[model samples]
Target: MLVYLRLLKESLSFAINALRNNKLRTLLSLLGVTIGIFSIIAVLAAVDSLDRKISKDLSSLDKNTIYLMKYCFGPSEIPQWKREQFPNVKYDEYISLKNSLTNTDQVAYQFFVNKETIKYDSKTVSDVNIVPASNEIVEIEGLNVDNGRFYTESESNSGTAVIVLGYDIAEGLFGGSEPVGKSIRLYGQRFTVIGVIAKQGAGFFGDSNDTSVYIPTNFLRRMYGDNDAMTPVIVLKPVKGVDMDAYKAQVAQKLRAIRGMKAGEMDNFFINVLSGFTDFIDGILGQMNVVGWVISGFSLLVGGFGIANIMFVSVKERTNLIGIQKSLGAKNRFILFQFLFEAVILSVIGGIIGLLLVWGISLALTQLLDFEFVLSLGNILLGTGISAIIGLISGILPAISAANLDPVEAIRTGM
Candidate 1:
């Protein structure tokens, strides 16, 4: 073991010396490896950061939550034309489901509306997201109120002019002052501020509660009647520990009965599960990973070839030294390992440089974009492991050739 360690030390020294002696050649050879590692690790780190952020943003909600709507969240077998013609989920249907569905924990009604502006005196916040939802949305969405309280069921049912401001909206309108009990104008009507949501950072796909305001769904219904362009959806949370498939089946049956669908007729509405949306995200991530690997694989191939070429040249240059070492009782295994270790050391150096670059850029991005970019330990290990494997594959042939040299013939040829 000591002898092998000594060989390793000598090989490292030789590798460094080679780098110093042929600086341009070494740099050129390492460029491919460095770029490859950078491309792969950077892509992976970005994807991982995005995935984590999405999971954190969604952590408060139950994965078993179901969204019943006219349109699906992901791709569906139903034709787009047919989906477009499907009737929207109504408040009455939501009420029926809430009262009849025994397997559900909670049910809420919401309207998907366009961006609108809010006015508090002369201070106007434009293009703010407006969520018109039932009071049950507070429990279903796991909303946190930093001040006052969400509108009560009576307020929602009565279509009272009460609003819950998001963190940013409240700050924009009232600054450091208490926003609750203040009046805000929307759709040319005044509404009393009932609550303010706690601060929530950016969410996946730009959906954040920070710049939003929630009002009673019935208010919107009364303002525009049910024939407006707004899409109404029913959100349902299933009871814990219930069989999800069975629960979903029950939900579909109860909705079918309420909607008066015939036994053989197809259901008009789409049932989108939260877990299914997560699975769709996973699929997208998987595709990105595959593309990254394929593109980076080409760069690694070029790097492997460069290393192999340099190793062959090194063997040729050291023919006489190899012959002398063999004559002085050096074993073939030692000669082979010496060259192999040199290749590995060179590749590992390139990989380490790439990792450093990634770390620096990650820090810069986090600061500049106000988004976290993580470089996890597992990804660093993967980069190192991949580099070592490339080195081993690239060095085998050159090392074998050096180890098999005829001592006298190599000496004569060198001379």
Candidate 2:
């Protein structure tokens, strides 16, 4: 063991000397490994960050949650014209589903509205997301009130002029002062701020509640009647441990009955499950992972070749030293181990620099954008392990040739 340690120390010293003496050649040889590590690790970190964000954004909502609406969340067999002809889901339908559907939890009516400006006295915010949803949305969407309270059933039914401000919205409109009970102007009407939502940094689709305000859907309907610009949706959260297929069938049947659709006519609305959307995103991410592997595999292959070539050159240059060492009673295994350790050490140095580059970029990106980028310890270990493997594989043949060289022949060839 002590002998192996001495060999390792000597190998490390040789690697450092090689790097210092042949700066350009060493860096050029390391470039492929560096780029390969950077490529693989960067892709992994990005995908991981995106996956984490998705989990965070959807954590409150059940994966089994369904949206009953005219619009499809993904591609549909139904043509665009037919979809456009399908009437927007009515509030009555939402009510019917809430009452009639089995294996259900909370049902909510939501309005998809255009960007609107909101005002609190002189302070104003534009292009803000206006979430006009039924009071039950609080339960269905798992919304938490940071201050005051979410709208009550009575307030929703009566279309009371109350609003819940998102965290950043409150900060923008009221600064340090409390926003609850304060009046805000939107849609040419005054709404008393009744609650504030917790700071939700970003939503699943780049939408954030931070710049949003929630009001009763009834209030919006009462104010504007029916406008083409506003589309209504029924959001449903099914009970856990239920037969999902049977539950969805029952929901479709109830809605078909409500819409008076003839048998075999096909229901006009789309039943989009949240799980399917997440699965679709997962598939895309999987493809990205595969692509990253393919692209980086080539780079790593090139890097391996580079290391092999460098090792061959190193063996050639050290033939005289090897001959001397063998003449002085050094074993073939020691010579082989020395070359192998030097190759691995050199490759690992390149990987470390690549990892440092990734870490720096991740830090910069997280600071510059709302999204957070992460480089986990597991990935760091993976990079280092991969580098070591590349070096070992690349150096094996050259090290064997060095080990097998006849001391007399090697010394004469060097001379």
Candidate 3:
């Protein structure tokens, strides 16, 4: 064991000396490996940032609340025929679904208005989002009111035209003045501000909560011209002791019947459980992992080719040197191990530099994107392992040639 360690130490020292002697050649050979690793690491950093932000955004919703939408994320668009079927979940349907769920804790529907603007006296603010949803939206969204209360069902049904401002919007509209019960003009319609939502930190894309305005779903519909067929979103919460999977299945059956879906007709509505959303995010990351590996592996291959070419040149230059080593009674295995160790050392150095660069890029991205930087220890290990393997394989032919050189002939001919 001690002998093995000593040999390893000597091999490493020799490899380092060789690299130092030919700095330009060593760096030129390392370029392919560096480029390959850089590509993969950049991708990893970007994907990591995006994943963390999306996860946080999705997690903001109550775990018990299921999101009912027309389509899931990604490229799939909801079919027009399917969207037409649900038009709007009427007051009656909402009540019926809520009543039918024995384990339901809360149920709410959303009405979104994009043209919503808030005006205080002469100053007007755009980028105001208005969501007219049931009071249950507060509970489902884990919203905390800075002051005042979320409007009740009765207030919503009454179409009181009262508005709740997100933190930023409240400040913009009323400044230091108490905003509650104060009137603000929205799309030429006057609304009494009733509450302010507590500040929610920047979302996945660094968007602040202060830009939102809330009103009753009924009020939003009345003010913006309700399309009876417009159901923006449905939030459902299941009670304790109820099986979520079974309950979700039951809920789907009821919704299909309400929407008049036929058997095996492929229901158009989408049900988004928290777990399912998490899985979707993981799936996207998994694909990115594949891409990173393939691209990095290709780069490693090119680097290995560079090493093999270099080793071939070294073998030709040192033909007489190999012959001298053989004449001194060195074994073929020793010569082979020497070249292989040299190749591995070069690859390892390149990999270390590449990893450091990746880490630096990750830190920069985290600051710029305001998202998490996830560095996978597994990926680093995998990259290093592959690079070492490339070194060993690329050295094989050159090592064999070095080991088999004829001492008398090589020394005499200087070839």
Number of the top-ranking candidate, with lDDT as the measure: 1
What number of clashing residue pairs does each candidate have, in the order they appear? 0, 0, 5
Q: Pick the candidate with the highest TM-score.
A: 2
Listed in order, each prediction's TM-score against the native is 0.96, 0.98, 0.79
- CA displacement after TM-score superposition, residue 113 of candidate 3 (Å): 2.9
Candidate 2: list runs displaced more than 4 Å: none
How much does candidate 2 score in TM-score? 0.98
lDDT per residue as tens, model 1, 275-339: 99998998999899889999999999999988888889889999999999998889899899999
What's the distance in Å from true for residue 303, model 3? 1.6
The Cα local distance difference test for each model comes to 0.91, 0.90, 0.75
Q: Candidate 2's residue-wise lDDT over 1-415, tens digit each?
A: 9999999999999999999999999998898899899889988988888899999999988999999999999989988998999989898888888888888888999999988888888999888889999998898878889899999999998899999989988998999998999999999999999999999886758667787888999998898875678989899998999888898899899999998999999788989999999999999999998999899999989998988888999999989989999999999999999999999998898888889999999999988985789999988999999989988998899999999999998898889
After superposition, the stretches of candidate 1 with alpha carbons farther than 4 Å from their true spots are none
